[model samples]
Target chain A: MDEFELIRRYFAPLSGAHEDVVLGIGDDCALLAPPAGHELAVTSDTLIAGRHFPEESLPFDIGWKSLAVNLSDLAAMGARARWFTLALALPEADERWLAGFADGLKALADEAEVSLVGGDTTRGPLTITITALGVVPAGCALRRSGARVGDRVCVSGTLGDAALALERWRAGDRDRSDDALDLRARLDRPTPRLALGEALRGLAHAAIDLSDGLAADLSHLLRASGVGAHIYGARLPSSAAFDRLAPAAERTRLQLAGGDDYELCLCIPAARLSEVRRLAQQIGVALTDIGEIQAGSGLSVLGAQCEPLAFTELGYRHFQ
Target chain B: MDEFELIRRYFAPLSGAHEDVVLGIGDDCALLAPPAGHELAVTSDTLIAGRHFPEESLPFDIGWKSLAVNLSDLAAMGARARWFTLALALPEADERWLAGFADGLKALADEAEVSLVGGDTTRGPLTITITALGVVPAGCALRRSGARVGDRVCVSGTLGDAALALERWRAGDRDRSDDALDLRARLDRPTPRLALGEALRGLAHAAIDLSDGLAADLSHLLRASGVGAHIYGARLPSSAAFDRLAPAAERTRLQLAGGDDYELCLCIPAARLSEVRRLAQQIGVALTDIGEIQAGSGLSVLGAQCEPLAFTELGYRHFQ
Candidate 1:
């Protein structure tokens, strides 16, 4: 069978039926009707085999992370996940890998209540491109340009675990301690803060998903909003796994410059902090206050003593 | 500079502002509000370096055709093009290539009246994946499943020129005959039948864009409609260039199985033939009646002498 037929048999079934999806896999284009009065939030992310993840990463993990990162983008915008399309290129047609990949994708998609509407599969180097679509009420989209000076900077869940996991794996640490396993899971299947984002719609002024470390991503938010930020390093939440796995200095570096943590970093007004905290608690996601948006230019990272901290690198650079 | 910085300098300008687009390039996701009472049609197509096109193909043409194929899918659905996102992977950051590629992409996008929304670029083997979004009135979408037996099969413009062009190019024909250049143009920059498709909205029962060769693509339409088709070789439209450059037998073969034509293959009711023809004339697209849909299963190709034509290959198969 050809690659097209393989996709029809294995991957097409993963495009779950939805009322909004008028046409699905069998057509030249998939038809979808976004709910009335809602703006569609669209994002695309491409993951290459060796650069984005280790070449030896499991197919299931790769599939999960590919969708996870795209979903994280939608989550950052406080949009409700709706539909997505995938463009996957592979070296060869392997049935077992395809099945595992589809399973991993479907599991996360089902959790987010999103459906696969369309996709294209081709033969080439292994790469996956996913375009995810979501919906938000018109004019209610949370944007990076809305952060105001004096807003409390917050992040959901812990940081540094995914990068820590990669560091350990690269160092040939095969002992799989509980912390190691936990960190590895974070690297493989980072959770998107969809519910928390949806809950923070009006309360948060601006938000961004942490894909390129807190230092860099927050700087993006600050730049867009034309403000500055003061990040209290001591308050940047790190998982217990991170603390157990690395030294304090290394842990601080990971929290500041590590990538692949798909958590939402938000800027909320000081007046709404109590309500935002209540919403986070109701949603069952940890919301930690890590910094404050300030009136100035550039970002300032503070140590435990409220003194400026210096770092050689702020985030992962793709072409550096 | 990094890949992200490169995108900021080169591609950010290509993202023209559209009022419906609440947010464009520099955000976590692009926000768009589709006109009320319209359903969105989304399609994705990926072009790999050597697999989809020649390894030596101009970066500009690669960018144009990558978007063109996705637009063709939208055209086939009779949807009005709206927005698109690109996920581009490259072997290295070459500024000249990026500028030329952006120029080709922007040229087509301007003609289609679609705005670039969001995208991701990374380092890898060269590949371009484009997801185009369009809008159609609710429940007015043209679909492959709507064809019925006794429907007349029709096509827009010409067929087989692209495949014939590829054959000649492979045979080392470098001297540019008018026919060679015409066929080469057809292969490189085939126009999407957007106007004709939109005009056929209520007139055509079913439709599909020709990407895979006619024989294979027609089979897809038949399978979706639970019917069959008989394509008359004599009626299939061939360009003047195709007739001049290829042998009669070779022309017949290419017409049957050549891919990348990017024309609209549609099914219209026999009773509405005159009205459809008038609409085609008004739209300035040459619509040719090729055959008819039958009540049985499978497809049959008949020659000028009413004899069945046999073929060794059906169309381009990805994994063959």
Candidate 2:
């Protein structure tokens, strides 16, 4: 099919081709008439083969992960996903590859209620960049700088499973028939936590997504909020796969520094802990309190008496 | 400087630091509170090394062209350029490269009245993707399907200059000086014609930017408007470089098919021809009528006796 028709069948239907989007997929540019009295949350992510993912990763997973990662960023801000534009540069226009990729993209867009509005498809190395727009009530979106001292640090969903799955996948373990296979699939294709993020709006004082590992992402929130945090190693949620690798400290390290976690790291007032628990139940995601924002500088992991734990680096640096 | 510090100093200041931007550059997401009664226009473009440009292109030009190309899409839809988010995946965080790149981005952004709202920086291949947001008065944006049969087809500014510059740069043929060299610079850094787009809002029936050559981009408009057109090659506005090229037909071919001309292709009814000319003069740009939409399918190029012209290939195919 031609480019215009492809967008109409897959993208326009997801974007709804409705009044919310004044100009949808078929236009020269997408004219988005965002809902009145709401704020638009914008975020962009670029995924490159051999860099962001395995060079041999399936095209469908690539499409799913690229959009999923960007949606996670919006979720961190407590915004409801609305529309997205994709800029896909492929080495060649392989029909079978595109159909699979589009199927994966449509599946997530349909589930998230985000329309694939307008984008550019060019020839290049396999690269996909998605720009997602979400909406939140005026003056109510979550921010990284709102975390205050004495706030309990909470995270939605488990951590380190995706990283462990990546490690297992790299080791040539193709056992997808078991339960751990589901975890491996989740690593390949993440589910952006939009519902949980929306539910945490009034409950979360500060929020950030764990795309670059918990420690690195949490460091960003702490830095923006001008506070420090003390994470409890005993309380860090970890996958059994990671726990089997080394001692408890190393598993905690993985939970703290593993990239591609895609969980939400939020800070809520200590008094709001019960309410946070209730919201998590309503959203059907486990809420784990792993740390506390403190009136100091830098992040610290503690033993029973709150002494510092040691690690060579805080998290994965992409350059390294 | 680190990525965080660079963003705060260079980008945060450029985002206007206003209340409408609920979240600025430093957060996981940038929250934009769109003003009342206006629709947001969104478009994205990704420029990959050795694909969108030559491998040895300048970083400053890369930065300028990335945003300008997306802004051209906004202009095509008659959207007021508002803000943009950049997703940059680079091999390293070289301070000098970033300083020059940010300078070019800031320069163009300031001139277009577009702010740098938010983005993500990662270590990967040198890939630059920009998602631009614009605003159009409610129900006032020009679209690509508004053209009807018998409408006069017009184009703003001259064509083929960018392609000529790229050819010269590729061949190392730097024979000209002064104005010609400056004209070549225009190819590298295009003026998106935002003001001209806004001026044509009430006059032009349908419009699109001349991105993938005049013929290809106009073909898109024609396909969308469900009409055909006849155009004489001699009526097109061209540069003296066309005269320098051997064989007059070759010149005409390049003038028609050479891409990267960021001029606006506008369709106006016979009644609005004089008004189109007036707006072009007010905007200090040329508007030349070279064709008309007809009740037919497919584009036809007219010769002395309206004979069809043949081409070795159609204008660019992105995934070819």
Candidate 3:
């Protein structure tokens, strides 16, 4: 389908059903009239060619991941997906590639309940930028600065599976050596835990998505909250994907420094840890007690014996 | 300045001194209440290197034009400027370039009263994408589908100057000719005509921006409205820059087929013509009567004596 037809099919229905939305995908502008009790959360991210992903990655994955990453940012703030706009640049518009990309994008966007309100497509080296807007109760969104020294740092779902899967894919293992087909899919389609994030409202003092790996993402929370962290290395969730393929130290490195994991990393106070756990259970996602916020300026990793450990290459830097 | 400092300095107060904006630009997101009585208008556009603009173009100009184009989209729908988010991609984080770009962007944004709410920056070939959000009274947005046969098609401000300026820049005549300076600036920073758009809200039956040139953008409106247009060529607006350089025939070519002028093209009903003219004067932006919606399936251009004129390259093709 051409861009217009594709948009009409997938995006028109999203706005057609929502009372809060005043307009949708057909016109030059999508009109929004958010309900009175809600506040808007907005975030944007861009992924460029020969970076962010493998040089020859499927266009469909690129499309899905582009929107998914931005959605994760909204999730980190405990917001509900509402609308999104896309800016896509490619060498040229190929019908086959566009169809597949649209299909993949629509599948994910439909699942997230995000209306594709507007977008622009043009010619350039393939770059996809998605800006997503979400809604939250007024003055109730979670933020990084709300974390306290006594807060227990927690992560939703498993960590490092995406990174391990990427390692295998980069090495041309394709999830075979470690038999990590599921892990590889997790890496390819790292679902943003939006429901869990929304559920963590009033419980999480600080929240972040593990897009740039847990080590670096945690560092941002600590910096924002003016605290440090002591993460138990053994407490980090690891699957069989790591056991068969990577050495202990290397696995730890992957778990800490690897990127593209869209899981949520949150900080809950000691008094609210049980509530956070119960909420995770309600959402059917695993809640791992990864560490605790400390009154310092850096992060320390604890061994199985409970001794502190150090690391290098904290996480991926886009410029680096 | 670092990102945080830059954000605080440039974007912190975009929510306005008024309370309609429930959230401003400093947090992980910006929140909007939408002023209780208005419908929101949203549009996005992306400018990429070696494609949307010439490679020799200035970064500041790129910033201005990028935001202006999206603003023009809002103007087409007769929407009032409210807020916008910018996404910039550059090869590296150069403080000098950032300063200049932000300065230029803020200049136009402030003039339009379109607040700069939020955005993202990354490492890549320079790309500027902006999503402009504006407000229009409920049931009053001038859309493409509202045009009808016998409607007086009017255009605001001048046309063809930006397109001619682009040709001049492409031919490298921009620097040597002092006369081309204004033309170059037109190409670099076409105004969005927000005041005219706001004034035309009730008078316009249909409207669109002259970004892809008057011919293409109008074609989009006529197509959307399922009508045809009869535009008088002699009645079109031309700049002194065009008269001083290009021949009359070339100027006609520019007016007919060149893109990026960013003027507002609208269709007003025959009955509302006088009222529309009054509103245009009230806004102080010239509103020219250039065409009329006709009950046919194709656009026809009339010369000085009302005879038909022919042209090539009707407008830009997205894939090409």
lDDT of 3 by residue, B148-267 (tens): 999998888877887777776677663657668878888888888888888888788898888767777788788889999999988997777777876565767688778888898999
Chain B TM-score of all predictions, in order? 0.95, 0.91, 0.92
CAPRI rating of model 3: medium
Q: Which ten-residue region of model 2 chain B has the weakest summed lDDT? A: B311-320
Q: Candidate 3 on A233-309: residue-level lDDT in tens?
A: 88888766566656565777778778877888889989988877887898898989988998987788888898776
Error of 3 at B198 (Å): 1.7
For model 3, the superposed segments whose C-alpha errors exceed 4 Å read A1-22, A172-178, A312-320, B1-28, B175-178, B311-320
True contacts kept of each: 0.95, 0.85, 0.68
Model 2 / residue B240 / CA error / Å? 4.8
- Give the alpha-carbon lDDT of every model: 0.88, 0.80, 0.78
Comparing 1 and 2 on TM-score, the stronger one: 1
Interface DockQ per candidate: 0.92, 0.71, 0.61
Candidate 2 segments whose C-alpha is farther than 4 A from its true place: A1-19, A171-179, A239-249, A311-320, B5-19, B240-247, B304-320
Off by more than 4 A, model 1: A313-320, B311-320
Full candidate order by DockQ, most accurate first: 1, 2, 3
Clashing pairs in 3: none
